[model samples]
Every structure is written in structure tokens, then in C-alpha cells.
Target: MGVLSNLKPTESELEILQILWEKGDCTVRDVHEILGKNKDAGYTTTLKLMQIMHEKGLVTRDTSSKTHIYKALINQQKTEQQLVTKMIDNVFNGSAARLVMQALGNHTASKEEIDSIKKYLDELGNK
Candidate 1:
């Protein structure tokens, strides 16, 4: 378990959180603008979700002005690591090979991505 354990966002909340993660610090309007692209997300919806996310400690709010800006409190990499570890444990039956294969099967990787994976494996072998 990590610092954000037992604290995960719903799909809608994850959408807002993803915006904040990308923007670093943004107003509710900024988040709304991004999420509104794919769906019908009202400004107030983004605003309310951010307030709830702040309460959940998933985001840090700067209350310097009337429009408080929000940013993610946790590092993306750490969260991904924890989530992947949990997936490997539960869904993969504790097999890293099965997990990696399942993930790779789902996407078309670029040449750069393939090279990066090979390089990473080479480094791991060195250790």
C-alpha cells in the first residue's frame, strides 16, 4: 500500500485528475475545457470534482485567489508503479511475464518504444 492507498478516484474524478496532472496547476475552467472536449462536462462539474479531490488529498489546492488552482499531489510514476504492482499480483497471478505480454498485446508500439524496452532490459541484465 502507498500513501494514496484506499483512495482512488471514480472515472469522472479520474478525468479531472488527469487534467490536473497534465496541467500541473490549473483552474477549474481549464480542467473543464479539456474534459469538455470529449464529453459534456460543465464548468461547475469540474469545479466540484476538484474540491472533492482536494478533500481526498489527491490534489493540492492553492487558495491564493477567488479561483483556487489545483494540482496532483502524487507523482505519476509512483502511482503507476503501485497500480501495476497490484495488477501483476492479482490479475497476472504474480507473473511479470504474463502481465507484460498482456499489456504489449493491447497496443501497437513505436520503434522508439521497442528500443527503449530493449535498452531497459539490457540495463537490467547488467545489474
Candidate 2:
């Protein structure tokens, strides 16, 4: 698969993607207002990015009305899985165990969450 075959997003594009993922589908104005809270993004920037994203096949555009509505074309879970695999390959030499171990060592988990994780590990062991 191409690096972005599953779904690749450039750094600047992620903010808009996040909005789509969060809001389901929205107009450029809606995405701009939400992003404007965190950054100096303008309405036209949102408009241009949506157009570019539509061209990239990252999103679908509906021109059924005066205002265009944008929606993500890819599944969020699948995209995240691809991104995690790519990150593990690049930063952890593709050793998922090492990546999990590092993250486990670096972050603290609640006891309940730890128990859940152990249960999941047990389930995987059975498989």
C-alpha cells in the first residue's frame, strides 16, 4: 500500500479532518469557526482546504444547496490504525510489542484500565 493509500493527511489538513470527524459533516464556515478558536484560521482557508481535500479524495463534497457540505470518505478507526502502524514502523522498528512496552512504561494506567488491558492480552493469548 502507498504510505497514504489507506488515508494520508498532511499536517495542515489534520485540523480540518479533526473537525469533520468530530462534527460528522459541516460547512466550511462551521469548520472555520471551530478551528478559529484554537488558531488564526480564516474562512477562505477552510474553503480552500475543503476543496483540496475533496480533490485528494479524503472527503466528499455535496453541492446540493447554496453552501457546500464536506464529509470524510474514510473510516476514522481504519485511518488511525494505519497511522499507528506507520508510526510503530518508523519509530519502533516495526516491533509493536516494543511500542506497547514503551507506551506502557511511559504512561500510567488506572487499575481498572490495566485489568481490562490484561484481560485483552489474555484473550489474545488464547487466540
Error of 2 at 75 (Å): 1.1
What are the RMSDs of all candidates, in order? 1.5, 2.4
Can you tell me which runs of candidate 1 are displaced by over 4 Å? none
What overall lDDT, based on C-alpha atoms, would model 2 receive against the true structure?
0.85
Which digits, one per residue and each the tens of the lDDT, describe model 2 over residues 6-86?
457887787788789989999988888998999897788878888998889888999999988899887777777888898
Global lDDT scores for all candidate models: 0.82, 0.85
Per-candidate clashes come to 0, 0
Q: Top model by lDDT, which number?
A: 2
Where's the lowest-lDDT run of ten residues in candidate 1?
Answer: 2-11
Top candidate by TM-score: 1
Error of 1 at 75 (Å): 1.4
